[model samples]
Target: MFQYFRDSNNSKNQVSEFILMGFPGIHSWQHWLSLPLALFYLLAISANILILIIIKQEATLHQPMYYFLGILAVVDMGLTTTIIPKILSVLWFRAKTISLPECFAQMYAIHCFLTMESGIFVCMGIDRYVAVCHPLRYSSIITESFVIKATVFMTLRNSLSTMAVPVLAAQRHYCSQNQVQHFLCSNPAVTRLSCDDRKINNIYELVLAWTITGGDLGLIILSYALILHSVLKLNSAEAASKALSTCSSHLILILFFYSVVVVLSITHSASKTIPLIPVLVNVLHSVIPPALNPIVYALKNKELRQSLYKVLKMNIKKT
Candidate 1:
């Protein structure tokens, strides 16, 4: 419902709902863009579900790294599902109106999942580090208890840390503007629409980004550096190659995830010059990694590949 009010001196209306402008420069071809976006969303959901199933069914696949992977699959699905359907609705059906509560919920989910994903990556990096650098201690250090604890801790940390983002946004008085430039209810996009000052919101988000994402990335880098050093010290080239091979899938996923994030951040800064680019990149960020993570792991991990084939064959026979 659209709400309006007139003050003593100035006329202003409280924004009850926000209109999502999906893409600025490509309205003519925006409907066509929905096809690929829908495909990516479908792929992300199915592939991540498949990964979760394979991990659960295969007894041999139950380990710390795989457990972390199962968690990643869940996070990836959540990350994509939070924003894609609404985006597709905006694209295909031209359903752009979102209520304030729905907008806040979407914003909270997006930030929480994003932070969780980064935390999971950091945990996965630690798993790789321990496995490679101290093979003998890997089992004792990266146990199931450790995985459970890490997952719980990160979930709590990310949830609490990101809760304030939407809370802060919701508290603001949206007196005039209600059209959000981006497809989703992002913090920056939503907060920018507020008539009130958002300096506190901006500053808190900046510190939170650095504290969570930046901290996670730094930990991941440090783990990889140690893993690399340990691998280089191995006596046999074959051993070193094998050691590095185990980390290839992880490394690739990390690169793809963080590289897109970096590019998206840059595009956001230059959004004035390249508005459409940021929107496209942001959409891709939601879809691509989730769609590709399962494929990459299946391709790189022989055990996972074989398990997937077995699962597929079993399903085929049943059908």
Candidate 2:
């Protein structure tokens, strides 16, 4: 199956398209599974769009934190949209063939948005750290202009760094198997298909994964640690409780994001026995969070709850 070049006479022949298996173990029921997957895609896209609309319309939400949240909502939508639509096409329509250029495009988008999301989380951590640890300085520290600059910095940093991945992967010689194991154009999944020497690609991916994702995670931990320390310093139990409560939603989102990611990594490594687990997790990691993030924020945030309630009330009155 890993035959790209025909022979000495046709050595220049190379793969220009790939087939996505789209859940091999349960291939028979893949169509049935598409129902929930399609719904999840709808939910994620709608929820993120709603969040953006609410943030944009509500002047009260024009703060640094909300700005970061808006960026995160955009990232979430991008992340899921990059993978889920292609998945639905495969599962529902049996459109599994994707050209190499299109595959590389998807790969770059997935990496860019995931990294940007991680960076946005770190910004949120900083916002919370300032709000909880230094309430007085929060206003001065996290201004609208500051948030814009941070957004730009995060976008450029992730986009420029991740640009190399698709470029490098596209340059490789794909000689044999043109079928991707996962639903999406994942870095390693696509790279493993190449017949060229992939040592540099693998090493580069590892270094960036650790440096970018690991570094962002470390900063998030440190921000929360300081937040906890500050909360403990509060003399009144009620004040400490309030501070901790404010962080609960953020911590939940962070936990969910990282936990799924870690599970996906583990499943990929241990996929020798249960090969289906990694593929499923890879798809889930993209959609589940985007679908649930807005709900999480609305439930835990008083301002957001009020804004949503107001929007609903106005819509009902119009009807």
Candidate 3:
């Protein structure tokens, strides 16, 4: 699958394909990793699909919170799908060589979906804030139209911003070093292999990361802070507890998602010494939170659980 082109000035060949090293220093045991990864991928895909179906089927779940949840389900599936299959292929079949175009596409999809997920988290936080802080105005503020607009805005914002990462990466000149030392075509992983000055790519990625993920996280934190203040002012402990419970699942999802991301970033810095850790963390980030998201929501949400039960009961009887 390797293609090459001669540079105009130099006779050196430019790389047009990349080899994905799934997990460095663990080549012998790499195939063993496939089963668990495949299971997690299946679980993530199925659970998110189930969440979408339940949300669509249950009239009671057609509210702002559930609408955001549905969007999140879609994003989670996209995020996992962007990389897991290729990772699995690398592990199971040793099909590690990826063409330039495919690598760039994967890079774009992964970052785009990641940013979209962050945006959805921000939207969910806003929904919770409105519901808790201004109960009477919740309906007016978080209507279907508001949901539609927020979804559209989130999709466009992340899509356009994340596109720049891969676009910049594609413009770089890749020489002989085409081996991406990661399962998927991560921006840094691929860009660092280019035999070109990566200062601009590095700076843009840093600014983009802080702008999208950091900015979204900041907004989510502010929304929760306001929610906490309003919940505290409630006269009854029951009201406060109820409001907190409503946010608990979201908080858990946010913690799991961002905590892995933080760890992954940290490990990347130390990856020179502990190379395997970052790759493992990257796989975990792509799989674990996504697999657990729907399960957490279903367990925490009484209405969703009941709806799921009703659906299961009907399916069982039909069988």
| Pairs with backbone N, CA or C atoms under 3 Å apart (clashes), candidate 2 | 2-176, 2-177, 3-176, 4-175
lDDT of 1 by residue, 181-228 (tens): 889888878888888899999899889988999999999999999999
Identify the leading candidate in terms of lDDT: 1
**TM-scores of all models?**
0.94, 0.94, 0.94
Which parts of model 2 have CA positions greater than 4 angstroms off? Answer: 1-13
Model 2 lDDT vs. the true structure? 0.86
> How many clashes does each candidate structure show, in the order listed?
0, 4, 0
TM-score of 1: 0.94
Tens digits of per-residue lDDT for model 2, 224-307: 999998888899999999999888888999999988877877888787678799889888888999999988998999998899
Q: What is the C-alpha lDDT of each candidate?
A: 0.88, 0.86, 0.86
Task: List, residue by residue over 1-319, the lDDT tens digit for candidate 3.
Answer: 1121113212332775899987888877788988999999999999999999889888989898999999999889989988898888887778999977778778888898888888999999999999888889999999999999999998999888887777777778787798888888888788888888988887988898788999998999999999988888889999899999999999999988888878888888798789889888987888888899999999998888999998888889999
Give the lDDT ranking, best first: 1, 3, 2
